[model samples]
Target: MNIGIDIEEIKRFQKLLKDKNFIELVFSRDEIEYCSSKKKNAVQHFAVRFAGKEAVWKAINKSKKLVITDISFKNSVLGKPEVYIKGKKASYIDISFSHNKTTVVAVAVSSK
Candidate 1:
């Protein structure tokens, strides 16, 4: 088992959101849609998701060819985050996210 964690300031993503290319490079379409749907809290959502992807990348420790967009997420019925990789559900990876008024954090545990 491998575990990874990441923390980031929500304000940083707020600034980064202005760059369309960065958004496209880092997040998947589904992630964009979900985060954008938050409207007022979109930046916080994006930051958390971004950190989630980072944590997942560290946990998997894959090659450099693995881009950030290769990891994605979908919220379950109870609003729990579920991890997906390369467009498929990654059952072996368990992830969670937490955030506050200014920061967001994510942790991933992989049984691979």
Candidate 2:
């Protein structure tokens, strides 16, 4: 089992979203919706997604081919966002995102 967690302030996310590629590199539709529902800024949501991707990469041993789209959120019965790694064996991933007026943070954990 491996775990990787990341957190960032909202202002940092605001600046990073200026890069179009960065936005496209992360964020699944469900994640965007989840962030939007939490009243987080679009850029902040994107940032969380980016952080989630990086955390997942780190947890999965940094596979170069693990693009953002390769990981997705499938809602559990409890409505939590369950992480899925495409075309792989059963694994576990946990992701969470939170934001205040000035900061946003994301955390991810994985199990082999």
User: Whose lDDT is greatest here?
Assistant: 1
Candidate 1 stretches with Cα past 4 Å from truth are 62-65
* Model 1 TM-score relative to the real fold: 0.93
Q: List runs of model 2 lying over 4 Å from the truth.
A: 29-40, 62-65, 74-77, 87-91
- lDDT per residue for candidate 2 within 1-112, as digits (tens), equals 6777767676777776677675555665666666557563676666666666666777775644676677766556886656777734234677776666776666777766
RMSD per model, one decimal = 1.5, 3.4
What does candidate 1's lDDT look like per residue over 8-57, in tens digits?
Answer: 99888888999999999888888999999999999999999999999999
TM-score for each model: 0.93, 0.66
